[model samples]
Target: MTADLTVVHARTLTLDDALPEVEAVLVGGGRVLMAGSREAVRGAAPGARVLDHRDVLLTPGLSEAHIHLVTYGFSLSQVGLHGARSVSEVQARVAHRVLNTPAGTWIRGGGFLLSELGLGEYPSAALLDEVSPHHPVMLYSRDLHMAWVNSAALRAAGVHEGTPDPEGGRVVRPLGCLLENASALVARAIPAPTEAEFLTAARAGAQDLAERGYVSAHTMAFEAPDAPRALQRLAQQGELPLRVWACLPHERLGQAQALGLARTPGGLFQWGGVKFFADGALGSRTAWLHAPGFADGSGTGIPLDPPELIREVGRAAIELGLTPVTHAIGDRANTEVLDAYDALRPQAQARGIRLRIEHAQHLRAEDVPRFRGLTASVQPIHLQADGPMIRSLMPHLESLSYAFRSLRDAGAVLAFGSDAPVAPPEYRANFAAAVTRVDDAGERLAPGEALTELDVLRAHTRGPALAAGWDDEGIIRPGARAAFTLWDRLGGNAQALVF
Candidate 1:
């Protein structure tokens, strides 16, 4: 058998509309050579290495549409708090980590929900101090929008009662929390990872995704400069397991322009988009909603990047052949972003750039239609935790929250993602959350918006491919990349099959 040629026999679900299904596929030189009946494919590749997996289902490889991958990789080694149901549980976890960590060492962890913690008010610094006073501890909310730090951590950061909130963030009073841009206030004090650490994290994250059956990822640009550099280094060394389409933070746009940066293609790692944040996330009560925000009396959430900046710089991004990818979680944020895009859409269309909106989570009914031609990179698994929040906090827009079907029907490319570190990159959870519409509270959230399993698969595969301008990666056509995900059954256990 030739090293570069292989024939895979399986129940193939070729996402290609032209050929919905096939029995086997022939692959050579990292691309699909042919896909047809097993006998026909065998006839075409007589000497190819044959992988007989007729019992499994083969589909186009999965793609993680949105993730702070490097950060997620680092998180794997830190304290995991994804399901700590109460404040005591959070404290216990922190104490456990501190037991082994050195005294006065900074402890970092996250992935807890305010609602899940069962706290009526913001958790106080005293709560954590009771567990780990010797070591400074800071745990991020599940959304990464807020940081819950102990008094020691706060003192180390010089945060005090009189300390004013940062321009786009808040230092919650009584001194236990930092919100939005305020996270950096404490983050600045923590030690930064070395370049080698970044490289290790990059490898760990990429390998984790590949092991989870993803062939590619669109890593959002919310990480440190070294993070992407780490991924780039992996790609250059030929150690990267998944193809990556990365974004540059909007703040770096000027420098990128000066360096004559544009979409650099051909490698497994490519610069594909410019990312912007219109608002923060929901878990932290920082989403920029309309009037009567956060029925819990958290006030109208903070807005970050101005829509004007997004509109002006977004055009420049498109001119540089980069898609303008913005994070808009609240209805108001979406409306403002949609308004900004209304002006930039012409330029985007001219350049064949599809504007991307990450976390098009909550939308005004009118704004849903605005997403018609844009990419709605939403995370459905979030619905599992956010269902009750939507009911209690933003019931006014409950019906339109995470409106997957409406967005898809309106022509918005439905790109599903994990936003890992916020949630794990589990496609099975995505399938269940999207198809079931059931949340942690056992309540259905907008069941009418539920998607079929096939729809979910397309969102995970083709939608991300189109979003990243990866025309040859998401389908199983002759010219498509020979990367696939084998499942015991569709949406079941996954294993990557890359030639």
Candidate 2:
């Protein structure tokens, strides 16, 4: 069949090692027909429409390697407290939201780091109670692994001072916050959004990523099942702006297998991985660690999924044609996950499935090499905030935190993302964080691990492509996908230009 053709002319970075740069590309049938000089492409596609963008820099479309899609959409409308520097500041924000919101409605917001709040210790419920007495309120830490709630919210979730901490989580003293699984106790009390709400959130999130120059995202499965359902609906309706590679929580493995679900890829959405959390996050003080844990003597971070469980369930996931994606943040967590992956590696390789470790954030020097063939799905944007914490809390391991260069040199595929809502899915922030290796304290953390602008861009584009097993999407080459991101300069002002 004859193809409808168009010629796109720009200062193009093909990202194809074979043909690294091009002046023009001929696109047809949603794929690249040829990429070379304008005259050559024009001759290759006679009668093709010419869309010149000579002043712009065109590269393969960007991808968000990790994010919670629908959740980020909802966060767009929720109270934002990412930069709150003091307890009074947080209270002020909640007070403002309270004045605008109704009395009985639950108020939700997050994005504050404990270290940034100038509180040597965790804030108590009284702080939020003073600002919001009538409405139940839950404010998540920047990491999302912990939640600070008011008295009303604590009562609603039946979490009191005497309540025993659930296994794999904690209920802090004086009843103001919940950690790890304990956060779920209160979260379960929050009303679930309707299908329509989910759809709206899904649309909002996907469009937000597209607007930020991301052509695709790997929506990590920490959200409700309705989240993926909403995205699927959008894809079915042809309204999804960014392609999504989503995962199911390991808890849903049985249900998925019963439903005969497999690695089905097409349209704008696909399910390719089964997600597991090996430990909690840093800001939450629950990141499972080895000896001499947090400098504050908080003990080694909490471990979530046991190594035994990961091996068992991870194998089951691979047997069913899914990638085993585990979140390992702390050094001990990475060690345990690497041990688990060791046994599963043979199975993964035989089946052509890539084993993935999300965050792989803090690692022991020896464990770095274990990631040689694995995908290190990381968020460099976290470094902008975590740099100070790493110095103050885990100084002994500072050099190994966010070890981008080490992982890359060892052959691990570096997939970059923002872990959005936890942080904004802003590519510029990512570029700055990865390239500068500087933190909020104006100090560099492992400057030796800093990446070049091109390296960061590749992680945003090619790395995600490798993770999603999409050889066609991250390069501008003959037979590649016709999606492109135009930038005024690399890592600068950008927009998606997908055909």
Candidate 3:
């Protein structure tokens, strides 16, 4: 049944420096054999089966550099609140869901930003209490850094007026919300999904990404361990469509080592990094910042992992052949992480592993250069929503915020993603956010920081490919994996084409 070759005739953008553009590509055995003019490709493989796509544009398959795959899949079935602009709207949505389901069942959903809700202050339990007094309810802010809960759920987790805040997190006053690690108090009480449920979610997530033209993703770990297990099961059954590079939470490093886990590549799924958080996120008012933080006087945000621990564990992770991927949002967090990475850089370089920083969202100009030789895994889609907040909260650092071009010019590899479940994995939004530099309010936060279309494309493709150590992907040339995204135009309607 196998053909000698599969000749794809289209406007191919190889994304290779040598063969930047071609009219046709001949693929066989899941790898590209020749890329050149139609006649040349036909000459290379005379008996090849031809797939003529004359008007379409073929480029390397897109890669989502950061996402919670299973979490996003689960979110698809939950109550959606991403565009809810007012507390009343949220109440209405929750009330509608409450009307359909039986009483007393746990209700969970998220995607509302505090700023978007037009709340002058932290929301109270009374708001949600008015809607679902009998049902336990927990909702997450847009950034997933904060949780909003009703009184019923609060009591279930044993949180009370006298509950002391956990380290690296806070219990907001009046018993309504939790920030950072504090959210885990209530979250732990929620029943875990069964293995079958996990497998279903994994399939849903991977298939969704593949349908959106993504050939691979880097699933950051913050979920139950069962999440990656589901992915592994899918890979074992040969049912996975997208290539996945998953990470383990640093707390599970011991468990990973005990299980004899190491960086094992060349499969549909692989473990490539150990994830650590240096600070919380912006929407939660918990992004650890420098002095004069939050123009509204919220004080410098909370820090999660201590720099010393990051340095020590990071060295161990690198020595184990895993990338030390740290999440650093605020300027102070970035500075501290940079300091830690500086100490571990020599060892990482010796091991041939490039350390990575997720959410390098905000930075100090001085620390910008320190990102040299590091992977800045960022979500430009956040800029569309975070623009006004960045201005209102940290005007002093406005110019340096989301400094994509600056980091790239200073030798940092820019890997773009959407941080799904926080924001939908919509590549068009990423393209618009980075290329236009315009926000929801129609204001340009940092117009000078805008990137060219090609620049953004590379970040979404080649950058992620490098991060995952997949030399054969994210390019369309001889010997490269025959996975491509056919686009109507660059950054336009697209679909995945995997040979």
**Once model 1 is optimally superposed onto the true structure by TM-score, how far is the C-alpha of residue 127 displaced, in angstroms?**
1.1
Per-model CA lDDT versus the true structure: 0.93, 0.92, 0.92
Query: Candidate 3: global Cα-lDDT?
Result: 0.92
TM per model?
A: 0.98, 0.99, 0.99
Error of 1 at 108 (Å): 0.3
TM-score of 1: 0.98
The CA-based lDDT of model 2 is what?
A: 0.92
lDDT of 1 by residue, 1-499 (tens): 5656899999999998898999999999899999999999999778888999999999999999999999999999999999999998988889899989989999999999999988778898999999998798989999999999998998898988898888999898888999989889989989889999999999999999999999999999889999999999999899999999999999999999999999987879999999999999888888999998899888878899999999989988999999999999999999999999999998999888899999999988887778888999999999999999999999998999999999999999999999998999999999999999999999999899999999999999999999998889889989999999999987899999888
Candidate 2 local lDDT, 50-101, one digit each (tens): 8989999999999999999999999999989999999999999999999999
Sequence-dependent TM-score of model 2: 0.99
lDDT of 3 by residue, 137-162 (tens): 99999888999999999989999999
Residue 472, candidate 3: Cα error in Å is: 1.2
Which candidate should be chosen as best, given lDDT against the real structure?
1
